[model samples]
Target: MEKLVEQVWDYTKHAKFYSYRPNYAPKTIDMLITLVGGKNLKVADIGAGTGNLSIMLLERNCNVVSVEPNDAMREIGIERTKGQSIEWVRATGIDSTLENSYFDWVTFGSSFNVMDRNEALNEAHRLLKKGGYFSCMWNHRDLNDPMQKIAEDTIIEFVPKYTRGTRREDQRPIIEARKDLFDNIVYIEEDFYFHQSIENYINAWRSVKNPYWDLETKEGNELFEKISQKIIERLPKEFDIKYTTRCWSAKKYK
Candidate 1:
């Protein structure tokens, strides 16, 4: 478990590129907030990298505690969300060090896969009020889309066995396995389009933790360069990338 925490430091190099990543679908977020009771609720956003979801929650009037372990990511999150109703804590999801039974909700924004899921669930249970909710979500590129298919082909051309890892998996089964800690499980997904310049789109890939190779390695650098060049040749200056924001949420049992 400690090793997993240490692995999070790899994001230090990719921290700056996180902003180029897509935000959660607005309607999806609104539905989540509504399901979890509503605005001005207390939220503990675990693995809150660079304040993407945190900023969205803040915009909806939620008092957010952004728990992030990576120094580079957390620093950027703090700077981006400065002066807002937020508290920045340097902590991992499995052991947030937050008071027990205090928060209305605990959430992971594109970050649940890095931690031990069972431990993260336990930590969420510990931090939430009796009826508080726990949720984790990720924005997945819609690979079936024409433009996205080009990106997929580009990646496969470099790493033939590339896999998206656990982030793209169905999380319902994992959450349901912890029946003792939670109940009333729910899953939601909404498709949305993110518009960005080709350059920013390429930068977003820099933030991804590629399973095939480490970006620091010579091979990985070459692979990235190749993909970037291919993308530039194929894509327009600016375009929309279709994405599906998938979220799984459960109510903490009293």
Candidate 2:
């Protein structure tokens, strides 16, 4: 599974995936800012894919260390954030090589599930000063929406082995399990909707390399064909998809 994820993302260019990916609601960004108390605080955005979260942080006047291991994604991130003074570092969550007890905040945006959670949390705790914050968030597809349920269910039936194609985990239980590492651990969630053309939506899934690669075989293509046809036939020309961005934060105590 891990290798499959690496395989998929390694080829992920900064085009449609970055362009069509869901945005973390502005209010959620504001909440993270509030949790950390303000802007211009030092931040390490681990797994900062294409610098989406870093861009948000920079807009709030935060100094960002955009750590991403994938060169393709990192390059696109750098390209996308051109003229903005973001410090882009090529590193993973467990091996950031950043200084300890220095950054005011550490964050993971839609990328925490990729890491060895315990190691990453420890690294996050180590890199933050006493009372500094560490936060992780994801823009999750809300399964409860009617249109979305059809969409999700269709994919599941078509791709029986389908998981989110990457690790789909809730960090709350892990956070609580390692309570000794931090203080005031808390979780926050909010729902927002975004609309995209059905084509763009289908293209987004096509960008998911693992399943798409597997489905590239004769047998798999048939399933994807069905999914595409269903989307075209059932969904509106442009329709809203509900997403929940769940962010969890804690302050390092020791």
Best by TM-score: 1
Model 1 reaches what TM-score against the true structure? Answer: 0.96
What candidate 1 gets wrong by more than 4 Å, as runs, is: 1-9
Model 2 Cα lDDT, one tens digit per residue, 1-254: 23323443464543337657777999988888888885579999998878889998999999888998887778888998998868898777887889989899999987777767788899999899889998988887888987788788777766677677334566678888888897788788899998889888887666454544344477667767888788678888888889888888988888
Report the alpha-carbon TM-score of model 2 versus the true structure.
Answer: 0.88
Q: What is the Å distance of residue 227 in model 1 from its true position?
A: 1.5
- lDDT string for model 1 (1-254, tens) is 35536474478888999988989999989999998995699999999989999999999999999999888999999999989999999889998989999999999999899988999999999999998999999999999988899989987887788888899999999988999999999899999988999999999989987667578889888878988999899999999789999999999988
Window of ten residues with lowest summed lDDT in model 1: 1-10
lDDT of each: 0.91, 0.80
Best by lDDT: 1
Give the per-residue Cα lDDT of candidate 1 at 98: 95
